[model samples]
Target: MLAALAVVALATVSGGAAGGWVASRDGAPGGTPASAAPVPAELVTAAGKTVPGVVSVLVGGAGGASASGSGFAVDDQQHIITNDHILAKGRNGSVTVELPDGRRFAAEVVGREPRSDLAVLKVPPSAGLAALPLAKPGATRVGEPVLAVGSPLGLPGTVTAGIVSALDRQVRLGDNRHSAVQTDASINPGNSGGPLVNARGEVVGVNTAIATIDGNGSIGIGFAIPIDQVQQTADTIIGKGG
Candidate 1:
């Protein structure tokens, strides 16, 4: 059955988990059974590498309206990439970015491309956010493992695991039609604009929208803007000094 598409950005007042498992012996007291499936080491490593680069974007708009979503550092220049719709929800209001460690900074809107559903924000150089690596152009393949790293439901530093379910999936984002990388990762509200990274900790796409049945929550189907488009648009916005 066809499902409705949601932007995955949470609208509310500004407010905002780690994934790790310890291996236990066959009968270790109060420990997970040794027969339990182990978490993939690659995914664990990727999560660690990605969390620090991801940030929570809080927008305070006119009349106390606010919206929150996720973003990731893209360059050493303190530029962060996020979904433009999140900014739209705030009615062009002030933006703030909160680091994974709880440090918050006032952010300036560098630029936004609504058609592409992407936006860029810049914080002070003192923020010292780490830039996430991007996968090579045309590098993503179907069936590869991936992680959706973002703040789902206002919970910061959240990571969900899944695989590339399809490539070049046509979907509507905002008012534009674009191709997106489809995955089964659990992309919920507040995950907008966050990075979808591969097992090697390289960004493959920007989590943007999810298809939900009956306006419900994520049903294992999420879409991300391919990283190549993100890089091109982000570069143009940065170059134009927007």
Candidate 2:
């Protein structure tokens, strides 16, 4: 009887009856020198203008499977960009995007590239969907002030200020070469797929991963997918035959 049930459970999970699994840290890295800067009111104001594009994505399904993450609008048509891990379950689940003005809408996965951990979603166009301007990847300088905007730990519209610690940092994620923008910004759980913008409010990267330990949290080592790659992928996804 137990063996039969095990098989049934596996079949159900494989058949999209179970929700997608959330990504977790292996362990936190050791401490590093603080590089956080006082968030300027100007930066906050700039972020406020951009934050409307940053949205909270809620994925839900039957069998009590659900997950949440962040995403950003990339175009005037309500095209959204996010990490592939956030929408891995495909049509088995439903996605809802919540904007800063308390408006929410149903979203659909238009394209996904798991190797780069990027995905594109689509929703209906509405007012106040300010798309963030994309910055060149090689343009970001080390020690430059930056900010991370996302729903960290499910806190909507959360903003954290820090500096770009490095650029073109290579993080190996399961046979994929992820050239990332490293920052000292505090990116906790639920921040995946959000924007990592420079002081000018131009999006330089997409926050994807962070280093953490069992007891320690946010080791100051956070990684984001470069904006250039994001654009390339998004263009292909939104383009014809994609």
Please name the candidate that would achieve the greatest TM-score relative to the true structure: 1
Lowest lDDT 10-residue stretch of candidate 1: 16-25
lDDT of each residue in 15-125, candidate 2, tens digit only? 221232322335545679589656687788768777877998777766656667788989888889988776653334887888888788998778878888888988876
Stretches of model 2 off by over 4 angstroms after superposition: 1-38, 89-92, 240-242
Full-model lDDT for every candidate: 0.87, 0.75
TM-score of each: 0.87, 0.80
What TM-score would candidate 1 get against the native? Answer: 0.87
Off by over 4 Å in 1: 1-36
Please give, for residues 31-149, the per-residue lDDT of candidate 1 as tens digits: 46568467799999999999999999999889877888899999999999999988988777899999999999999999999999899999999999999999998999999999999
